[model samples]
Target chain A: MPGTETAYQPTDRTVPTRSRERAAYDRELVHAILDAAYVCHLGFVRDGAPVVLPTLYGRVGERLYVHGSTGSRPLRMAGQADPGLPVCLTVTHVDGLVLARSAFHHSLNYRSVVVHGTAHQVTDADEKRTALDALVDHVVPGRSADSRPANGKELAATAVLRLDLAEVSAKLRTGGPNDEPEDLGLPHWTGVVPVRTAYGAPVPADDMDPSVPLPGYLAAL
Target chain B: MPGTETAYQPTDRTVPTRSRERAAYDRELVHAILDAAYVCHLGFVRDGAPVVLPTLYGRVGERLYVHGSTGSRPLRMAGQADPGLPVCLTVTHVDGLVLARSAFHHSLNYRSVVVHGTAHQVTDADEKRTALDALVDHVVPGRSADSRPANGKELAATAVLRLDLAEVSAKLRTGGPNDEPEDLGLPHWTGVVPVRTAYGAPVPADDMDPSVPLPGYLAAL
Candidate 1:
């Protein structure tokens, strides 16, 4: 899964008319972008209207897995429909604020991945367990090995859905803002204020045993 | 906008099937969650399939505005459709990662807002200008006041769409993970690793005039 090279072919649906130069088809770039983010916006059509909800996701090679309660709308819909649920999943990270001389040119330097495909409910028990493990490890590395695996009851209540990384594109906007030549002379600061996502020290739960200490994996973060 | 109190009536679309206890209909809570995030996932149907896009947005009172080049597919479709574009807009902030004793109970403490409505193309020139100003100011406070406004040509090429906050809900997961009682003694480290978004030092542009310095608004950040 690591160091694999496969560029997805751009389709009519994946192509953007504006700023086409920012789009990328490289597999490594897509995987890196997807791995960096913690959550994704899952979009599906309901009654001919689109509905987008934020949810956690995990990626393993060419497949992405998202899990939710069996009673959840998307999971239920996926199981009920004859065909799989058509969905669009997207992840984005804003790296910096691009401030320009002109307000019109002000923008954000960001990296985003958009995945379009039909998601089918994962049925196999082993695959479901693996997908759930991936989801846990996705939020924090080495997490899956540290925590207890799900039991049969818990596994039954959870529903995992998988989407192949076939129709995917990564778009990125980087560097300083592109201000007009005339506006460059204007008396305004022009630059990027970088944005960073950092993890803070862990806070123990109220009911946790005091004998247990902070783990090395979390302390490193 | 500050200290306003209004509660939205929860409809079936706004209610969550699972974890209903986390849902909130208070307008102030919804506004706070929306204001904290920089980007939103805009979802709409295209050719009977759902499409989700990450875009910049601005909120003014009960209305939200999203803008893009006229050539963009979503913007063009909104302008062409008489009834406007049926869309869903969502914003999410992941505050912390919850590592439970059991892997099944591991989750993220997050605040999210979901909005569903029809987005109409902004037709009035004055509203369009105001909306554009909001977009700039949204990214950086006091930015629109310091920078040059868009000219006629730039204005013509851009389209702004407005969505009223009629159908909205905010969901939040706080505190520690809900691990099962029997798993409390599991050897895994269990706690909340806080996640935070912060700004770094501003990087001046390559060709910027040296005389101009970073503005107070950005410096404070």
Candidate 2:
């Protein structure tokens, strides 16, 4: 199953060699973590300093896409250079809190994916529409078809950037904390404190045209 | 209540003047968003490239604290220079999924704080303990006191970085999507899809010493 491509030495960015086992080099694991996250932190350096922005993102097969206004600085910068903008995109989902017997061993149960790549701005007219659709669909599955497509002016003003799924890694921590054997006898309550995310009932806008019914995809979500 | 000391300026690093109004400068609003968040994205440039990492963080007064092992690159870098490491710290809470009448207007309802500063490593023994306590209390209140304090060896191995909350901004988008007046008459369902976070029942470890009872503070959390 892991014989799809030749393996390369994946650089350890966050966790070093001592914590290497927590890092997963599998593509499926990385993709799953990215797909499940609602938002992503896009990092880019502007004027020799680092800036991180939390934004919505979408994944299409082996490529990830992000969109912003054409006037946006980062979007414009990505299209300027030959290699585009060298960026690191990260998505994380906190699964649970690992409470260990020893304070030093306490940790969190989380699934995260980090992508290191040079993003190129999407310029083609048809491809822009396709990318926008993918972005909309990723946020709300069937709602893209029910809503009006972007007009020519709107499309022209928008900027879409695509980053390939290369140089990526997934790190996951699940189950409870691995407290030391000696600490197991310490009089401290220890376990996994669960964390969860939920969606509330959709509230229709007051100005909504009463004729239109809620879409099935939104209701399902 | 807008005191002179609480005022924040829009620097070149700040999201331009137009985007600045949408960016809140209020301290209370900033603290509310920060305290409610468990994780923050730390962004820094490495070798002319942007790198973003998601990690646990805590806020105490006007200072934000992030900790890591002394061997970590970022931590080591932060400890080197006198002025410290230039970093951008951001914390965001997703409140709702905004569904607009038109697909172009689709966005998220969120509250986020972005702090632009140079992080200084905490070296003093007393300050380190206080910062560590704040970190633990930020996650689980009172748990810091209940657990064993870090020993000299553990303290020496850990690195705590602090960023003052001076050049900070909090941006929030609440309510439903701001669809255009003309689009409001369109036959499309539009509104907000709320998002929520909840805590689940605690799962005690099998090897946990039964003598220690669940602390009231943790139980309340």
Candidate 3:
């Protein structure tokens, strides 16, 4: 298990004003939320305008890595020789929808982590390979070991960028909606509709060999 | 039904260089993706750094509205007297996880829509009310009609911003993973694991009146 003693020191950007009680600085909770979500929205500035792209991400210790084709705009920008790219990467898991008596109180139960920092391109070969493995393992637990590793040409074509988890905060809202005292008597129902991500049976590829059985790790999912 | 005749004109920024075939400019498809996803990552430049926030949003025709507290940074910035905030709003649905024979070929099947434009504060009371209702309905169909509408004080506390759907593009990755020809004989399993956002049974609030019946809209979920 990872150490729980270290907590992220929140910066001005990570601080929450509205519903401040939901904000968490504990590293354990932040790591848990990051680990659970496979995809993250990476925000970056392109020509003074903000651009958000959804992509796969992996976290290792206090560092998070995102890889993409070198030809991609965001990847090329991060790999540039100048100062690193300033990004705010966010991962959110919507747990449920809070149905309140009044429309104003209707909200979502969600856990979200926001990381604000500069991302630098990984130049070291060892770090790049490890990041790639982590990325695969992130989507599927035993995927990296089960599948063939990236070749030299493929590694060269891929760009892996790393961001330190320095300024990060996880905010989550749970339980039922907070309805007004008077609205409780309203005819409408008030409750929490839980939302969950479920995985269906693995569908074999059309060209897959008939003898190949589904892996245990995937079957477990 | 929405007309299928109109299509978004792709600009320099909206054009996709990678997987060009997956890029779509059809307004109908873009709207469908936006409507299906309840939450969107709103991206805006804050103090020269990119900030991406996950928030609830609603769409009406060609405009998308996101509501937040009046004191929130993004809302406040959008309502500023100067030029409106240039924002990128994105909604993504992860349909499935593609497990490929090679780790390098592993990918995801997803549908995502990106809207790039200026977001202006909706000051009109009528529009704000409609947007609020649309937001409630976005999460649960017929919810706005079933629930009590927001009163004056609640409306005062909320701030809604509107973004036009002019600069929009929907990119989707569907079907199975594309593995290398040589990797077809690999022992690893290769397939797509379908993912779905499922809704569990509703949990009534502690203060909910026992006499109140579950709403039909929620029951359908």
Which is the better candidate, 2 or 3, if ranked by TM-score?
3
Regions of candidate 2 where Cα sits further than 4 Å from its true position:
A1-9, A12-18, B1-4
Candidate 3: docking tier:
high
lDDT of 2 by residue, A1-221 (tens): 32355332377554453467788867777777877875899999888888888888888877899998887778988988677998899998888888876677778899888888899999888878888888888878887887778888779878999988777877788998787776667777888889877788889988887667878897888
Model 1, A100-185: lDDT tens per residue? 88888899999999999999999999899989999998899888998899899999999999999989999999999898877778
- lDDT, candidate 3, at B61: 91
Which residue pairs show collisions in model 3?
none
Error of 2 at B205 (Å): 1.2
Runs with alpha carbons beyond 4 Å of true place in candidate 1: A1-5, B1-5
Per residue, candidate 2 scores C-alpha lDDT tens digits across B1-221 of 22345556656666543345568777788888999987899998777788888888888788899999898777988988768989999898988989887889888989998899999999888988898888877888777877767888889888999988888888888888887777777777889999977788888887776667877876797
Q: Per-residue lDDT for B1-221 in model 3, tens only? A: 33345789899879876878999999888989998988999999988999999999999999999999999999999998367999999999999999999999999999999999999999899999999999999999899999999999999999999998888999999999899999999888898999989999999888888888888888897
Query: Candidate 1 lDDT, tens digit per residue, B74-100?
Result: 999999998999999999999999989
Worst 10 residues of 1 chain A by lDDT: A1-10
TM-score of chain B of each: 0.96, 0.92, 0.96
- Model 2 has a DockQ score of 0.71
Each model's lDDT: 0.91, 0.82, 0.92
In Å, residue A106's CA in model 2 sits off its true spot by 1.8
Candidate 2, which CAPRI tier? medium
lDDT of 2: 0.82
Flag regions of model 3 displaced more than 4 Å: A1-5, B1-5
Interface RMSD over true interface Cα atoms for each candidate: 0.9, 1.7, 0.8
